[model samples]
Target: MQPVQMTPAERAALERLVEHARGDTGQSRRVADFLLAWWNAGQCGSYDLTTAWGVDDTIMDDMCVVFRLASRANSYPETLGCGPQFEAIVRAWRPKLVE
Candidate 1:
Protein backbone atom coordinates (compact mmCIF):
# COMPACT_ATOMS: atom_id res chain seq x y z
CA MET A 1 0.00 0.00 0.00
CA GLN A 2 1.19 3.47 -0.69
CA PRO A 3 2.01 5.53 2.37
CA VAL A 4 -0.63 8.00 3.52
CA GLN A 5 0.23 11.60 3.09
CA MET A 6 0.79 13.21 6.47
CA THR A 7 -0.82 16.41 7.63
CA PRO A 8 1.35 19.34 8.64
CA ALA A 9 0.56 18.73 12.31
CA GLU A 10 1.53 15.10 12.04
CA ARG A 11 4.75 15.93 10.31
CA ALA A 12 5.61 18.50 12.93
CA ALA A 13 4.83 16.10 15.76
CA LEU A 14 7.04 13.45 14.22
CA GLU A 15 9.88 15.89 13.74
CA ARG A 16 9.55 16.95 17.36
CA LEU A 17 9.69 13.35 18.49
CA VAL A 18 12.78 12.78 16.41
CA GLU A 19 14.40 15.84 17.83
CA HIS A 20 13.68 14.61 21.34
CA ALA A 21 15.47 11.36 20.61
CA ARG A 22 18.80 13.10 21.04
CA GLY A 23 21.01 10.10 21.57
CA ASP A 24 23.22 8.68 18.87
CA THR A 25 22.41 10.36 15.61
CA GLY A 26 22.63 7.09 13.72
CA GLN A 27 20.24 5.27 15.97
CA SER A 28 17.88 8.22 16.09
CA ARG A 29 17.95 8.48 12.34
CA ARG A 30 17.20 4.79 12.02
CA VAL A 31 14.20 5.12 14.32
CA ALA A 32 13.04 8.23 12.56
CA ASP A 33 13.34 6.54 9.20
CA PHE A 34 11.38 3.60 10.50
CA LEU A 35 8.66 5.91 11.82
CA LEU A 36 8.37 7.78 8.57
CA ALA A 37 8.25 4.56 6.65
CA TRP A 38 5.66 3.21 9.00
CA TRP A 39 3.46 6.29 8.78
CA ASN A 40 3.77 6.49 5.03
CA ALA A 41 2.75 2.88 4.76
CA GLY A 42 -0.69 3.89 5.99
CA GLN A 43 -0.07 3.32 9.68
CA CYS A 44 0.58 -0.34 9.31
CA GLY A 45 -0.57 -2.65 12.08
CA SER A 46 1.71 -4.26 14.65
CA TYR A 47 2.04 -7.40 12.59
CA ASP A 48 3.22 -5.49 9.59
CA LEU A 49 5.63 -3.49 11.73
CA THR A 50 7.04 -6.62 13.30
CA THR A 51 7.69 -8.19 9.92
CA ALA A 52 8.96 -5.04 8.28
CA TRP A 53 11.13 -3.86 11.15
CA GLY A 54 12.34 -7.34 12.07
CA VAL A 55 11.18 -6.76 15.61
CA ASP A 56 9.80 -10.23 16.10
CA ASP A 57 7.17 -10.45 18.87
CA THR A 58 8.63 -7.59 20.81
CA ILE A 59 7.06 -4.87 18.71
CA MET A 60 5.32 -3.39 21.74
CA ASP A 61 8.57 -3.21 23.65
CA ASP A 62 10.25 -1.46 20.79
CA MET A 63 7.42 1.04 20.73
CA CYS A 64 7.87 1.58 24.44
CA VAL A 65 11.50 2.33 23.90
CA VAL A 66 10.64 4.92 21.29
CA PHE A 67 8.05 6.51 23.54
CA ARG A 68 10.30 6.51 26.57
CA LEU A 69 13.15 8.00 24.62
CA ALA A 70 10.89 10.66 23.20
CA SER A 71 9.39 11.46 26.60
CA ARG A 72 12.80 11.75 28.15
CA ALA A 73 13.97 14.10 25.44
CA ASN A 74 10.93 16.30 25.81
CA SER A 75 10.91 16.05 29.61
CA TYR A 76 7.31 14.93 29.75
CA PRO A 77 6.18 13.34 32.98
CA GLU A 78 6.52 9.58 32.76
CA THR A 79 3.02 8.95 34.06
CA LEU A 80 1.48 7.86 30.79
CA GLY A 81 2.56 4.44 29.65
CA CYS A 82 4.23 4.06 26.30
CA GLY A 83 1.33 2.61 24.36
CA PRO A 84 -1.16 5.12 25.67
CA GLN A 85 1.18 8.00 25.10
CA PHE A 86 1.96 6.90 21.58
CA GLU A 87 -1.68 6.39 20.76
CA ALA A 88 -2.52 9.78 22.13
CA ILE A 89 0.07 11.44 20.01
CA VAL A 90 -1.02 9.55 16.94
CA ARG A 91 -4.62 10.46 17.58
CA ALA A 92 -3.84 14.09 18.00
CA TRP A 93 -1.65 14.28 14.94
CA ARG A 94 -3.37 11.90 12.56
CA PRO A 95 -6.74 10.78 13.82
CA LYS A 96 -7.95 9.64 10.44
CA LEU A 97 -4.91 7.57 9.54
CA VAL A 98 -4.35 5.99 12.94
CA GLU A 99 -7.76 4.38 13.23
Candidate 2:
Protein backbone atom coordinates (compact mmCIF):
# COMPACT_ATOMS: atom_id res chain seq x y z
CA MET A 1 0.00 0.00 0.00
CA GLN A 2 1.51 3.29 -1.10
CA PRO A 3 0.58 6.41 0.76
CA VAL A 4 -0.04 9.58 -1.24
CA GLN A 5 2.22 12.11 0.39
CA MET A 6 1.79 15.55 -1.04
CA THR A 7 3.07 19.02 -0.36
CA PRO A 8 0.68 21.78 0.71
CA ALA A 9 0.34 22.91 -2.88
CA GLU A 10 -0.51 19.43 -4.06
CA ARG A 11 -3.08 19.01 -1.33
CA ALA A 12 -4.63 22.29 -2.29
CA ALA A 13 -4.81 21.15 -5.88
CA LEU A 14 -6.61 17.95 -4.90
CA GLU A 15 -8.98 20.03 -2.81
CA ARG A 16 -9.72 22.19 -5.82
CA LEU A 17 -10.72 19.09 -7.73
CA VAL A 18 -12.81 17.97 -4.79
CA GLU A 19 -14.71 21.23 -4.80
CA HIS A 20 -16.21 20.30 -8.14
CA ALA A 21 -18.14 17.56 -6.42
CA ARG A 22 -19.54 19.54 -3.50
CA GLY A 23 -23.34 19.79 -3.63
CA ASP A 24 -23.16 18.31 -7.09
CA THR A 25 -26.45 16.36 -6.59
CA GLY A 26 -24.80 13.47 -8.30
CA GLN A 27 -22.67 10.40 -7.65
CA SER A 28 -19.62 12.49 -8.31
CA ARG A 29 -19.14 13.40 -4.70
CA ARG A 30 -19.60 9.90 -3.34
CA VAL A 31 -17.44 8.33 -6.00
CA ALA A 32 -14.87 11.06 -5.54
CA ASP A 33 -14.67 10.43 -1.81
CA PHE A 34 -14.44 6.67 -2.28
CA LEU A 35 -11.58 7.00 -4.72
CA LEU A 36 -9.78 9.53 -2.55
CA ALA A 37 -9.99 7.33 0.49
CA TRP A 38 -8.99 4.31 -1.59
CA TRP A 39 -5.91 6.04 -2.94
CA ASN A 40 -5.02 7.53 0.44
CA ALA A 41 -5.34 4.12 2.01
CA GLY A 42 -3.48 2.46 -0.85
CA GLN A 43 -5.29 1.17 -3.90
CA CYS A 44 -6.69 -2.31 -3.61
CA GLY A 45 -7.41 -4.68 -6.45
CA SER A 46 -9.67 -2.61 -8.72
CA TYR A 47 -12.20 -5.47 -8.57
CA ASP A 48 -12.34 -5.14 -4.82
CA LEU A 49 -13.77 -1.70 -5.24
CA THR A 50 -16.33 -2.88 -7.77
CA THR A 51 -17.98 -5.52 -5.59
CA ALA A 52 -17.65 -3.60 -2.35
CA TRP A 53 -19.10 -0.47 -3.83
CA GLY A 54 -21.86 -2.23 -5.80
CA VAL A 55 -20.86 -0.71 -9.08
CA ASP A 56 -20.41 -2.85 -12.16
CA ASP A 57 -17.03 -3.11 -13.86
CA THR A 58 -17.75 -0.54 -16.59
CA ILE A 59 -19.14 1.92 -14.06
CA MET A 60 -16.20 1.45 -11.72
CA ASP A 61 -13.82 2.06 -14.58
CA ASP A 62 -15.63 5.27 -15.40
CA MET A 63 -15.20 6.51 -11.87
CA CYS A 64 -11.52 5.65 -12.03
CA VAL A 65 -11.08 7.87 -15.07
CA VAL A 66 -12.35 10.87 -13.17
CA PHE A 67 -10.26 9.95 -10.16
CA ARG A 68 -7.22 9.68 -12.34
CA LEU A 69 -7.94 13.08 -13.79
CA ALA A 70 -8.12 14.69 -10.39
CA SER A 71 -4.97 12.84 -9.34
CA ARG A 72 -2.75 14.09 -12.09
CA ALA A 73 -0.05 16.61 -11.16
CA ASN A 74 -1.26 19.23 -13.65
CA SER A 75 -4.89 18.29 -14.18
CA TYR A 76 -7.38 21.11 -14.54
CA PRO A 77 -9.66 20.82 -11.53
CA GLU A 78 -12.60 22.31 -13.39
CA THR A 79 -12.35 19.58 -15.97
CA LEU A 80 -13.18 16.88 -13.46
CA GLY A 81 -16.52 15.69 -11.92
CA CYS A 82 -19.00 16.92 -14.53
CA GLY A 83 -20.06 17.22 -18.15
CA PRO A 84 -20.84 14.69 -20.89
CA GLN A 85 -17.67 12.75 -20.32
CA PHE A 86 -18.89 11.81 -16.86
CA GLU A 87 -22.62 11.56 -17.52
CA ALA A 88 -22.82 7.81 -17.02
CA ILE A 89 -20.89 7.66 -13.77
CA VAL A 90 -22.19 10.89 -12.26
CA ARG A 91 -25.48 9.66 -10.90
CA ALA A 92 -26.05 8.82 -7.22
CA TRP A 93 -23.63 6.11 -6.21
CA ARG A 94 -24.99 2.82 -4.98
CA PRO A 95 -24.31 2.22 -1.30
CA LYS A 96 -21.73 -0.27 -0.10
CA LEU A 97 -23.29 -3.67 0.48
CA VAL A 98 -23.67 -4.50 4.14
CA GLU A 99 -22.86 -8.12 4.69
Candidate 3:
Protein backbone atom coordinates (compact mmCIF):
# COMPACT_ATOMS: atom_id res chain seq x y z
CA MET A 1 0.00 0.00 0.00
CA GLN A 2 1.11 3.54 -0.78
CA PRO A 3 1.77 5.83 2.15
CA VAL A 4 -0.46 8.86 2.59
CA GLN A 5 0.64 12.33 3.63
CA MET A 6 -1.64 13.96 6.20
CA THR A 7 -2.21 17.62 5.33
CA PRO A 8 -4.02 18.38 8.57
CA ALA A 9 -1.14 17.07 10.66
CA GLU A 10 1.29 19.19 8.68
CA ARG A 11 -0.87 22.26 9.15
CA ALA A 12 -0.93 21.66 12.88
CA ALA A 13 2.83 21.28 12.91
CA LEU A 14 3.22 24.56 11.06
CA GLU A 15 0.97 26.27 13.59
CA ARG A 16 3.12 24.90 16.39
CA LEU A 17 6.22 26.07 14.60
CA VAL A 18 4.69 29.50 14.30
CA GLU A 19 4.24 29.63 18.04
CA HIS A 20 7.77 28.34 18.64
CA ALA A 21 9.44 30.90 16.38
CA ARG A 22 7.51 33.62 18.18
CA GLY A 23 9.97 32.98 21.01
CA ASP A 24 13.71 33.35 20.32
CA THR A 25 15.00 31.35 23.28
CA GLY A 26 14.16 28.01 21.74
CA GLN A 27 15.77 25.38 19.56
CA SER A 28 13.14 25.92 16.85
CA ARG A 29 14.27 29.49 16.26
CA ARG A 30 17.93 28.51 16.00
CA VAL A 31 17.10 25.62 13.70
CA ALA A 32 15.02 27.88 11.51
CA ASP A 33 17.87 30.36 11.27
CA PHE A 34 20.37 27.61 10.55
CA LEU A 35 18.18 26.10 7.83
CA LEU A 36 17.62 29.46 6.18
CA ALA A 37 21.34 30.08 6.15
CA TRP A 38 21.87 26.68 4.60
CA TRP A 39 19.34 27.46 1.87
CA ASN A 40 20.99 30.83 1.21
CA ALA A 41 24.28 28.97 0.81
CA GLY A 42 22.86 27.01 -2.14
CA GLN A 43 21.65 24.11 0.01
CA CYS A 44 25.05 22.44 -0.41
CA GLY A 45 26.78 23.97 2.57
CA SER A 46 28.31 21.50 5.02
CA TYR A 47 27.84 23.23 8.35
CA ASP A 48 26.50 20.06 10.01
CA LEU A 49 24.27 21.37 12.78
CA THR A 50 24.01 17.79 14.05
CA THR A 51 27.61 17.90 15.23
CA ALA A 52 27.04 21.30 16.81
CA TRP A 53 24.46 19.72 19.12
CA GLY A 54 26.38 16.47 19.45
CA VAL A 55 24.22 14.70 16.86
CA ASP A 56 20.93 15.33 18.58
CA ASP A 57 18.30 13.45 16.60
CA THR A 58 15.47 15.65 17.85
CA ILE A 59 17.17 18.77 16.47
CA MET A 60 17.84 17.12 13.13
CA ASP A 61 14.18 16.14 12.95
CA ASP A 62 13.07 19.66 13.77
CA MET A 63 15.32 20.94 10.99
CA CYS A 64 13.44 18.75 8.55
CA VAL A 65 10.04 20.00 9.75
CA VAL A 66 11.13 23.66 9.60
CA PHE A 67 12.36 23.25 6.05
CA ARG A 68 9.18 21.54 5.02
CA LEU A 69 6.97 24.33 6.35
CA ALA A 70 9.16 27.32 5.46
CA SER A 71 9.60 26.21 1.87
CA ARG A 72 5.85 26.64 1.47
CA ALA A 73 5.69 30.08 3.03
CA ASN A 74 5.99 33.04 0.69
CA SER A 75 8.09 35.16 3.03
CA TYR A 76 9.16 32.76 5.77
CA PRO A 77 11.38 34.66 8.26
CA GLU A 78 11.80 37.76 6.05
CA THR A 79 8.42 39.08 7.20
CA LEU A 80 6.89 36.30 9.24
CA GLY A 81 9.17 36.60 12.25
CA CYS A 82 10.35 40.14 11.37
CA GLY A 83 13.79 38.70 10.67
CA PRO A 84 16.07 35.74 11.21
CA GLN A 85 17.12 34.70 14.71
CA PHE A 86 20.80 34.88 13.79
CA GLU A 87 22.66 37.04 11.29
CA ALA A 88 24.41 33.94 10.06
CA ILE A 89 25.02 30.24 10.76
CA VAL A 90 28.44 28.61 10.62
CA ARG A 91 30.11 25.49 11.97
CA ALA A 92 33.30 25.83 14.00
CA TRP A 93 34.08 29.11 12.26
CA ARG A 94 35.20 30.81 15.46
CA PRO A 95 38.81 31.77 16.13
CA LYS A 96 40.88 29.23 18.03
CA LEU A 97 43.02 30.06 21.05
CA VAL A 98 46.75 29.29 21.11
CA GLU A 99 48.43 28.09 24.26
Candidate ranking (TM-score, best to worst): 3, 2, 1
lDDT of 1 by residue, 1-99 (tens): 323344444345555554433334544434444543343334633223433353333433454554444444443222222345444444544467666
Model 1 global lDDT (CA atoms, 0 to 1): 0.42
TM-score preference between candidates 1 and 2, better one: 2
Estimate TM-scores for all models. Answer: 0.25, 0.29, 0.38
Question: What lDDT score is found at residue 86 in candidate 2?
Answer: 29
lDDT of each: 0.42, 0.41, 0.44
In model 2, the Cα lDDT at residue 79 comes to: 38
Please write out the lDDT profile of model 3 over residues 2-91, one tens digit for every residue.
Answer: 233435645455445444434546464454445545434454243455533732465555556655655655343444442333222222
- Clash tally, candidates in order: 1, 1, 0
Candidate 3 residue runs with Cα over 4 Å from true position: 1-33, 42-54, 82-84, 88-99
Rank list by lDDT = 3, 1, 2
Error of 2 at 67 (Å): 1.1
- The lDDT of model 3 is 0.44
